[model samples]
Target: MSSLRSSELDGDSDDSQLAAKFWEVKLPDVVPLDDLKAIEKTQAAEVIQRAWFSHMDKIIFQLLKHTICAAENCVTHEILKKVCPSEAALVKDPSVQCKVRFRFGGKNFPPFIVFKIFLHTGGHGNKYFSGKNTLRPSSEAVVDACKLMGNRKYYDQIIQDQLQFQKYKVADEVDVVTMKDYMHFTSFLDETPAYLGGKSNCWRRLSLENFPKTMIMYDIMDYATSGTLSDRLQKELKYLLQKPKSKEMHHDQLRIVSQVRHWG
Candidate 1:
């Protein structure tokens, strides 16, 4: 069995059940909120749950993509590397300026992580040029090749300037981040809805006021650039433990042949 480490951050002071959950991902260590609290509160005891709820509701107010993405970048003639997509910016200020690519299979697996573009390569922005896991044989080859080919333009523009490169990686190797962190994920507690993916959007909100893990698309891109995938290895996702707490092995997928064991 995989032993849980202090790194799991399970909100438990004692060690009993594992902390690092399949549905729970450790977000990149970003700056925590400075003297920030949930905008509102409930009549319940001053518990963390109530605090989280109040914070989430307020944060989602400014999180409407329609308000930010649609208005700012379009009017300012400036691509704010913050909230992107929906005809908005790509990456604003990323830790890794280069877009990291991983190979799992076909087109469904495009460059999984696209690093945000920093306005300048200085301070925290320098991770693209320097960092652990940033050092790779393929990346060096690309740089040298561009130099030898006399393609200083593509090299300088994309590689040096944009800090963009598509390195070969895998899901199990590097981090597999969603566009945002949906904190409302309830795996052990809520199983049926988990597979349904019905309230996925509802569960995922860009509310960081209370839940710092809640990220907008822009925030995610920033981490993609600066973050390195953990070397920690595990079983293939398709073979991992699933809900209803299964012990016996079963077919990977369902079809005709076998009669339903747990039918709704």
Candidate 2:
């Protein structure tokens, strides 16, 4: 009788946990700035600034969340059954490149696969803005955890029991493969806000203030309204894509590739 009672209690406990998990992963209401304030006094421009920052907070969170998950192991296989599942979604990294060259053996060996490797660092989630009421610097813990991960060894034993690699035997005359790694450094200062970290609507306080945010967004579109940089990009693309023997516009195609602006 005791064993049967324990089994019944376990089933009820599991159901309660499942219900809690479902509610945890459910979506929070999206904020619409215009709806929050009447457009009578506030211009659409400032309204949009708030909206953009709010939505950006969501995007930045996803980009960094997985990195935190891997770095801190904050979410365990067990918590996965209880915590917010949006936090547990699988992330795919396209770091290793594989090229296979087949070898013949009437019945035997596997083909040689050449691998080109790259390393990736990921960003944490919107939890950075979590505990808004507690005055905690948002997602700061996760961000610190992610940055620390970069300083650590990202890979485990090269030939551990679960994973291994064999050398790709290049053809007799081919050059040997070389491995290289590259890293870039960036410096960011000060605490960040939950939304629009440094962006401001200070102009909203002035009389007769007006903002044309839509026109501004439209004007920022590449090439068409993007102004001076557009001219340079056209020249660079023309130069790089030029036909080998075509001789016209030699001046246009001769400009330095580095001089072109990379951003769209």
Candidate 3:
């Protein structure tokens, strides 16, 4: 009876070990391949999102510091270098001049910030300085500005005021008889231009309304030069302008005119 009991106990032990080995082999097979892939993709996306947020946070911090310096009227070369080291380095050349403009609110307007960089050759009415300048507080900057202001309503009011101001300024500069005529001349056609499609028009109109006219013009010119614009559009504009060099000039002129249009 004792021998029989020992043999039975050994048999039970062997069964338990086999069961453990079977489960170990089947565990991986039980998890779906799709689930494993999904887990990997999620992990990758999380890593990318974390990197993007970290980058944006640094930009916001720098913008906030620059704003504070501007508000205090203590923005200097040293401060600018600290705030934007890369831009400062670019402007270190003697030919480049940097100007910082700030607008604080009164009863009519809210605060705004602008940075302009242009070529300075110590001459009057030079072609280089005409429209060859960098203007900042871009659309991205505007979003950052809204964040800094802590009030979207005020920022919206500020944008409206800026739109009005730009219109009046253009009219006064060009001696336009009325804003109505200006808008009529720049009006969107009933059909999209052959060079641009419906999708391009949609985005262009949205950009025109939301961003500064000069910046939009610069971007458009860049697109045209970089071949980002449609081949047909480039060919047509080049033919009409008669000179490839004049494309930028024409765009700049249009920019001034379009600034007055009430798209938004």
Give the TM-score of each candidate: 0.16, 0.14, 0.22
Weakest lDDT window of 10 consecutive positions for candidate 1? 252-261
In lDDT terms, how accurate is model 3? 0.42
Clashing pairs in 3: none
> Considering every candidate listed, which one attains the maximal lDDT?
3
Off by over 4 Å in 2: 1-42, 73-264
Candidate 3 C-alpha lDDT tens digits along 1-264: 999999999999999999988887533456688998999999999999999967644533333333333322433343336445676576565566644433322242112333333344566633311110211346665566467767866456457545544654431223345777555322321122322211111111111122233322323333422425434334333333332267575444343323333333
User: Which candidate model has the greater TM-score, 1 or 3?
Assistant: 3
The order of the candidates by TM-score, greatest first, is 3, 1, 2
TM-score of 3: 0.22
Local distance difference test, each candidate: 0.29, 0.31, 0.42
Deviation (Å) of 44 in candidate 1: 3.8
Q: Which TM-score value belongs to model 1?
A: 0.16
Q: List the candidate 1 regions with Cα displacement exceeding 4 Å.
A: 1-43, 47-58, 61-67, 71-73, 79-264
Best by TM-score: 3
Worst 10 residues of 2 by lDDT: 181-190
Which lDDT tens digits does candidate 2 get at residues 1-264?
999999999999999999998888767797688766765446787888889966644433332222222222321222222232332232221342212111112232211111111123343222222221223334676456446655342222212212311221321112234331111000010112223221121111101011111211111122222232334434444334444364434322332321223344
